[model samples]
Structures are given as C-alpha cells and as structure tokens.
Target: MSAVDVYLADQRAAIPGPSWTRRDLLREAGDHLEDATDAYTAAGYTPTEAEALALRDFGSVDDIAPGFRDTVAIGAARRTAVLLVLVMLPQAFLWDGGIELGASAHSAAPDSGLFHVLDIIIGYVGTAGAIGALVALAVTAIGQRWLRIGRRTARLTAAWSLATAMIVPIIGFTMLTLTGGLTVLLALSALAFMAAPFALVALSAQRTLAAC
Candidate 1:
C-alpha cells in the first residue's frame, strides 16, 4: 500500500465508533488526501513525494484521534439520549394499563401496604427518570448549539440513562407482581414494553460510555 493508505489504516485503527461513522470519517480523510496528492503531482512532484507531503499536512493519528473520538462520544451520547426519551416518555401509559389490569383482576383483594409503597416509589422514580432523560436529550440536541459539552458530560448522561433504565423497570415489575395479578400475558407485556425498551436504552448508554 501507498504511504497515504498506510496512514489511513493507522487512523482507522486508532478511532473507535460505529461502522457508519468510521466509514464516513475515513472516506472524507481519503478524499482530502487524494486531492492533496493530485495537487502536488500537478506541481511536478513524484507520486511518492506527493504522498509524503500530503500525509505530513494531514497530521498523525495521535494528533487527530482524540478529536475524532470526542466526536464519536458526542454522537453516541446524542443517540443514547434520544433512545432514553423515546423509551421513557410512553411508559406512563404502560404503567397505567398495568395498574388498571391488576386492580380489576383483584377487585376483591385488600390493598397490600407494600404495594402502595411500591406504587409511590415507582411513580416518583419513573417521573424523575423521564424528566432526566428529556433534559439530557435537550442538552445534547439543542443546547449543544450554544454550549460546549465534553466527553465527561456525555459519560455522565450515559451513567444516568443506565441507572434509570435499571431502576424503573425493576420497580414496575415488582409493583405489578405485588398486585397478585401478574398473569402470563401481563408478564409478557411487561417484558416486551418495559424490559425490552429499557434493555435497548441500557445498551445504547453502554456504547456512549465506551465511546466517551
């Protein structure tokens, strides 16, 4: 391979992100290098000499990788934020449905103290999580235009997302089970609606943390 090719390979090795992101970055860098090489070749430089000059101007992997990694982290953070909002916002409906079903199924049963306590806890925790996710989404999307946020902020957002993902679902499941109305259908619904989406958010948050 040519020097430019070698340099690009080194850059690819140094950067970590989703496949699409990595492809775009590498493609842009390659195009730039090709343009630079063509310009130098037109000025009477040999292919090797032009490649050398182009690579020199492009900067080394170590010099540029940190900036690229930061970009990846920010993108991951934005994705995680979006997923969190999407997953958490509609959860109230699911919770309501679950509670209604449980109540109807156990209309003659006395209310358990633990159930009441869990209901309150789930209410407060779920609300807090939804609000926090919305704020994270807003900051990453809109506030970013006016402010500078770094990897640390992205990592923190990911941490919060992961925590909320874990807490809300577990409590919701626990509360439903306490109602003595957890049927196979209800269990499947909870898994599909709550567990699945939260799992997705958790995965995205993990990716964001790794990127950051």
Candidate 2:
C-alpha cells in the first residue's frame, strides 16, 4: 500500500470517532500528505521518495492520534460517570438499612466498641470514596484544560473510587453481623443481593476506562 494510505489507516485505528468525523480527519490528513508529497517531488525527489518524505513530515500515527484519542476518552469518561451515578442512586436508599443494622449490632453487647468503630470507618471510607469518584469524574468531564490530569489517571481514580464506595458498606455490615446481632441479618441479605450489581458496574467502568 502507499505511504499515505498506510498512515491514514493507522490514524483511523488509533483514534475512533463518528464516521463523518473520521472521514473529515482522513481527508485533511490526505490533503497534507499530498501537499507534502508535491513539495518533496518539486524538490527533485523520486515519487517513492516523495511519498516517504511526506509521511515522515506528517508525523507518526502514534503521535498524531493521541490528542484525538484523549478527546474521545474524555467523552467516554463523561458518559460512564453518568451511568455509574445512575446505577449507584438506588443504593442510597439502602444506606439507612446499613445504619440501622450497625446500630442494632452495637446494642447487642455491653462492649460494642468495635462495632461503633467499624460503623465510623464505613461512613468515612464510603464518604471519601464517593467524593473521590465524583471529583475524578468531574475532572474528566471538564477536560484537561480545566483539571490538568491525564485521562487515564482520571479514569483509574474514578473507577477505583466507585469500587471502594460500593464494596465498603457491605463489608462493614457483614462484619457487624458477626457481633451477634440478628437484626443485621436482613441487612446482610440485602447487601449480598446488591453485590452483583456493584461488581458489574465496577468491572464495566474499569474496562471502559482501560480501553480509553
């Protein structure tokens, strides 16, 4: 294949977008290659040499495509963030369930210090995770110009934060159940059922960001 054809294909594979946008980008890239080839040919280079020189002057697909890919990543991250929040919203109503369970577990024994501590740990950790995820997702939506963080960093932070947020409460409640509190049985059952949804969303978000 010709040098321009190869470069265009590489660029298209490296950076994804709408069909019309990709076509427009490829068109612009083709024009640049043609102009560069003409300049090299006019400078007395052979056709083959001119094409090679044109491609070299245009820059590698790896280098040229990253900017476009980063832009695409931002958009992908934004959509994923919204989906993550939507999935997690139902879990909010379930928060009081954990609190009630923990409180009941605390009342089961004269020395329920560990249960209290675990309850506090769950609250603090969950809050931190939620905040971190939201901030990371917001940074992604705002783009690099506003946040100055890379797309990968933002994505990783958001994904891990969400995972932590989803899993910590369940762990805390499960531990509370060990304190001889039968009331927490219902809470534990509820959390067990919710685990699948949490894992599904977390894994999906991680894979999506890693692809980005």
lDDT of 1 by residue, 20-103 (tens): 666788899999999999999999999999999998898888998888777777778888889988998778765575555445
Give per-model TM-scores.
0.88, 0.56
- Index of the highest-lDDT prediction: 1
Off by over 4 Å in 2: 1-9, 12-59, 97-111, 143-145, 162-170, 179-193
Candidate 1 vs. true structure, TM-score: 0.88
Instruction: State the displacement of the C-alpha of residue 156, model 2, in Å, after optimal TM-score superposition.
Output: 4.4
- lDDT tens digits, residues 50-124, model 2? 999888877888778876666555555555566556545555455455545435445343266766677677667
